[model samples]
Target: MPVRPADIDLAQRLADAAGAVIRPYFRRPAGLETKADQSPVTRADREAEEAMRRLLDAERSGDGIIGEEYGEKPGVTGRRWILDPIDGTRSFTAGRAIFGTLIALVEDGWPVLGVIDQPVQRERWLGVAGQPTLFNGGPTRTRACPALRGAIVATTSPHLFAEGDVPHYMALVTAASGGAPRQGPVYGGDCYNYGLLASGHLDIVCESGLKLYDFAALAPVVEGAGGRMCDWNGDPLTADSAGHVLAIGDPARTDEVLEALRGAVDDGIAHDH
Candidate 1:
């Protein structure tokens, strides 16, 4: 049976699984390793997935689970739990308070319950498709910025940033609606930036080099607040495809920006292909 939207507790328990893994890591030095992609991997990341998998099997026995560290377990039932145990591995490995645990439920291939748990920040953001989003149970809405001018867009480069793609990304950011112009250089705060998008504190987050678990749990919270999450071409996100994610409030502003991005990325791809 499909869990009802009122079953927020189910989602809550899943988020708690991540906290369980982090608790022990917080007590000792992080046992970190590297992925083939050159990204940090930690015991907390793997243990969190293993823990979450166990609960999902015990609680929602018939449902499937698609995880980042672990792959998928096709279920007799159609419901699936999509998890990113730690969305910001770099920050987590550094013991910084920026990464988050993402837990979401999808039924018939559509996201129904989404939880973005930032344990370090002591905030857990939750959303159901038709309900108001909550920042620790208080209702929240996206910021109603008058225009894109002065709107701040946040993003990060986990690895591919320095491979000469920076110039194109910078050009698009420079050409967006409006921006503050005082920096000799720039940087961003990673997955915490997505929390800003959920809070409406920022305008957009454009990213690539992502995996399914990286973006799955984020789509609902962003979309629930009247924002949008899409691939580089404005397509919907999927549990299997994590090519790109864009969080933007203003569609006109986003369409304007993404069109340029597609052109630039396409041009680069054409040269390489």
Candidate 2:
């Protein structure tokens, strides 16, 4: 189904609402708490999501909601809104401006619209399927990276990767650097990296252990900006996709990135055998 202009407007409104609730809490003591997973959460995270949810409750009640903070609310419409109020809580706590609010509208499992909002910087990237991505309402495109050797790869952190997934990430990094370490993978940007990639500042971003809310909004932004986002196996992202994600700014480099990851997995399997 085609996304309506009104829906796109609503998405920006959702981002606006969340940003309002988050700004006052940034850099100030916001009553932090740790989730069971040992991840940090603050009042900004909860209230930002709440503010967005309240808007959805009033404007698009029929749309399902999958939020990082309050859990899920199923709706009758085949569409759902996936939200991550703060993609990098640690960064936010550290007073970094890289944290972002992610909003995605998925229809029947496929993301039709996505928004990456950085409240502090007041920068927003909006992407609708089949349309060019927009950064701050201006059309943006990913930069052309001729080869993996020159690609600028990024990830939130190496420690976030599971032990089994580490080798695959390392292999991609090694390949991206052409086997000689010359400025290792850029680390720690969370969703901001995707926005940068959309605006042509980044080349690739690979991550593991992400959740639906973490990545559901990222694919459209990356792809609409002349990039490609997929699983490590090279499949398009869906609601049911595994957490492993690879974002390549240049579409031509997809196979090279996938092969690097595949080679690592293959080597691991051979070693186990």
Instruction: Find the candidate with the highest lDDT and give its number.
Output: 2
Off by over 4 Å in 2: 265-273
- Write model 2 residue lDDT over 1-273, tens digit each, in one string: 899999999999999999999999989999999999999999999999999999999999998999999999999999999999999999999999999999999998999899999999999999999899999989999999988996899999979976688888888899988876775789999999999998999899999889999999999899999999988878899998878888899999998998888777655411110
Model 2 gets an lDDT of 0.91
The worst-scoring run of ten residues by lDDT in candidate 1 lies at 264-273
Clashing pairs in 1: 149-178
**TM-score for each prediction?**
0.86, 0.96
lDDT (Cα, 0-100) at 167 in candidate 2: 88
Instruction: List model 1 lDDT by residue over 1-273, tens digit each.
Output: 444854589788878877877866853677889888677878898998898888888888888889988889988777788888888777777677778888888877777778888876678888787777788888766676555555666776635553545655665676553344752122456666776778878777777766666677777788777777777666777755545667786555776666556455446511111
Clash pairs detected, candidate 2: none
lDDT of each: 0.72, 0.91
- TM-score of model 2 (CA atoms): 0.96
